[model samples]
Target: MERPFSVFHYGGTTSYDAHGGRRSRDIPAGEAGSGLGGGGLHRLHHHTDHDGRPAPHREAHSESGHGWERLVFSNALQAVSIVSVVQCGVGLSNADVVPKYGFGPIIKFLKVLVVQQILWAVSLSLCKIAILLLYSKIFATRAMVMAARIMAGFTAVWTVITVLIAFFICRPLSDNWLLDLKNRNCGNQPAADGTMGVLNMITDIAVLVMPISYLWKLRLETYKKVALIVTFSLGVL
Candidate 1:
């Protein structure tokens, strides 16, 4: 059966044909790739069932591991959507949509927005870390578990560094000896970022290859091993 999809964006609307390919455009109207209708919501149309249903698809079996993996992936996708939407909303809104007559008004609004942005990034990064941990579990080995721990540790360190960057590591704080926590930068950032980048690349290389290597020596299908490696790489990606 053909899948049902109607992506409404730019100046055009597209729907799937019975063969799951493009049907003719019902409307062609704004800027290309705007991902939005010009100054308004775009319209969409789809083929429907007699019961007036729309965009139905196959159901997952309850016992399927694939279904669970999809759930994890989708949860990660949800974080992506939430961050985009919230940031977009803030960008589209005025500093004070209902204006007040003071510097305090704009500053307060900006402070709230900045805090929200940090929260969004932290949540998304943590979700990504968790998804990688799940990937390690699915293809578990002694080395894979170690990789997971190392990745998790990096996540924690990065998160702390992010907090320090956001608050304590400002230029003003840098010169204040009493408040300063470290002489070196708290981030994994090196004096030469390339040094740190190489270290990260090496770690990612080991994490990506080690599990797949272990899986390969087992008698799993070639396709399965390749798929696992590909999906695991996406976590680091």
Candidate 2:
């Protein structure tokens, strides 16, 4: 019988004062807001998987070997969250990201919105790559490994395309935030954004469902299979 595949483990640090207050300190607030705070909750110790694949984030392989991926993603997300909070503090919210005031206010709001979207795209790309790495580490079958690699490649391509589109939607780049343009022409941004949003939702569904076949085909109990499917499906959210 094929053995059960185990998950990867890595070292993570959490800082807190002696009083044990401000749990927010243990998890960076920005990372928490962005759903990347799970890394910080992981224990700061190393444990190898059954397959002997050292935890990529904890292994002494690269310059900043330990928790590098988590750190990079967490920091990026934290910065974005901080800036977003400041933007919201200055009267920008879900109700109205764009203001109906002077040209200066409109441009400022647009700039903040653009920055938020760019950071969100970068965080999403980083998280996708991390997920693919973790999936490959845990799933040993050739098909499973190949599927993860293919997904990672597609994610990288998607990131590049989306970033390029965001930066170049309007010529001169600055035109994206400009309040008025007399002669300069711009493409149909709402249509492009809708296409990207649809593609993103489709890829998310694909990633969430990719392992169902392998999971259900396992020689496990029916209850266990159902439990696994339910657990993995949560990633779709």
lDDT of 1: 0.49
Report lDDT (Cα) of residue 77, candidate 2.
65
Clashing pairs in 1: 11-29, 11-30
Q: How much is the lDDT of residue 121 in candidate 1?
A: 41
How many residue-pair clashes does candidate 1 contain? 2
Candidate 2 least-lDDT 10 residues: 4-13
Candidate 1: C-alpha RMSD after superposition:
18.2
lDDT of 1 by residue, 150-189 (tens): 7767755654555454454334433322223465344433
Identify the leading candidate in terms of TM-score. 2
